[model samples]
Target: MKQARLHFYAELKDFIAPNGQNKTIVHNFKHRTSIKDVIESYNVPHPEIDLIIVNNVSVDFNYIVQNSDDIHVHPANASIKQINIAPLRHLSPQVSGEPRFVVDVNLGRLARYLRLLGFDSLYCNNFDDKTIAEISSITQRIVLTRDRKLLHRKIINHGYFVRVETPKIQVREVLARFNMYSFFKPLTRCTFCNGKLKQTEKQNIAQRLKPLTKKHYEKFLVCSDCNHIYWQGSHSIRVARLIREFSKTDSPLS
Candidate 1:
């Protein structure tokens, strides 16, 4: 069996097995192999990779693997000064102005969290990768997902790999990555429907409100798209607490 030497740098190492991490990894290969396939075989998604080097020379994903090759895989956000070589498909610049997203089904909770934070997040439980890819390209929404393969779609211009599994931590991961915490507008959007929340008179939506809600809450934000009403009720207290906790948690800026 022919063999190649490999190493993954920075957060890219998170995708591989423990044995393959933090050091040179030896991979045995048969027949011809592309660098992309070889890297994905180790479970690292191609879109998350910034650069690949073989035998100390920069190469692209389609570069065919050769026996006795020395490979280096760097994270998508690696500093050019660090590697002195650009990674293929550089993680696109975070779009200026408001950030929008087309999220995959597996990240439903993260989608809602992003919506609550006032980002325009569009997520459907049945969204296929092709639809997500098209929507991302046309609407310029960032593709947020745990699925590495979705980000690998060639049509995608801006996308992110949500590294954390927990919803709260995932929210933090996104905020820190895009520097979006400064823009959070709590309850400004409908968390369920992803529609702009509008201010409404208590009497207007009173028919839909519970007696307790009508009696207790004065101000409300109604969803223009879904007509869902939001108020600073008990849930708001919990939401506020969660926001405070996230703000206080030490997040590593990506």
Candidate 2:
């Protein structure tokens, strides 16, 4: 039987069985198998994989594993540096354009912070894993979750496992992860409905707001969908300061 040896690097190692790191596993095969199928067979999603080197040569997902091949897999989230003469060193494109996100139920606070940054972040506690996965694929939005398993799911092509535990930390973590700090557009989107905010005359919404709110806050933005009201209140100031502070730090994703 034809056979090949496999090695996983960095975070890819975390998915391996006990004592799997740096340990070679000999896989015997009858016919050619795609590198993707071989890796996913071991539970690694193809999108999360950044590079694969086989027998000292780089290859993409379509590369067929041959007899006696030595394969090394690297995760997209890893920060490793390697010199390579292999052809498979291509990286997935860096995330560009306006940042958008969809958060799992566990990340409601992070959702709010992303909204505060004026990003279009969708969040609903009612969405099941299947719904979240579907929304992510259809919208091409990045999935934010604390559930590592969700990120590991085969159908989820764009997802990130937020490592931070606290809401504030998670906010910073996401900003750093996406390099979105410099792109922050404060109070640009409706926090309640993920709609773009539009400036409205204070008199137009006078009856909708509390008397005190109408009296003190003359500037207003209203959601086109839910008609929710927003102002640059004290909370907005605090959020802005926090985002500014995070922007100053060296991003972890960099």
Return the lDDT, model 1, position 73: 82
Clashing pairs in 2: 58-88
- Residue-level lDDT of model 1, residues 1-254, one tens digit each, is 99999988888878778876877889998899888888888777766776787876788778999999999888765775755544444434547877888999999998898887788999999999999999998988889988888876767868888887888888888887777867878778888989999999998988999999899889988999998888888777789877676665474322
Compute each candidate's TM-score over C-alphas.
Answer: 0.82, 0.79
Per-residue C-alpha lDDT of model 2 across residues 1-254, encoded as one tens digit per residue: 99889988876765677766668888888987988788877766665678788877778878888889999888775655563464457644356787778899999978987887788899988988888988988888888987766765656777877766888778887777677766888777777778888999988988888878877888998888788988878787776667676566754312
lDDT of 2: 0.77
Cα lDDT, model 1, residue 18? 88
lDDT of each: 0.82, 0.77
Give the Å error, residue 98, model 2: 2.7
Displacement of residue 136 (Cα, Å) in model 2 is 2.5
Off by over 4 Å in 2: 1-4, 14-34, 37-43, 62-67, 77-81, 89-93, 250-254
Model 1 stretches with alpha carbons more than 4 Å out: 1-3, 30-32, 85-98, 152-157, 249-254
Pairs of colliding residues, candidate 1: 50-87, 51-87
Q: Please give the distance, in angstroms, between residue 225's alpha carbon in candidate 2 and its true position after superposition.
A: 2.5
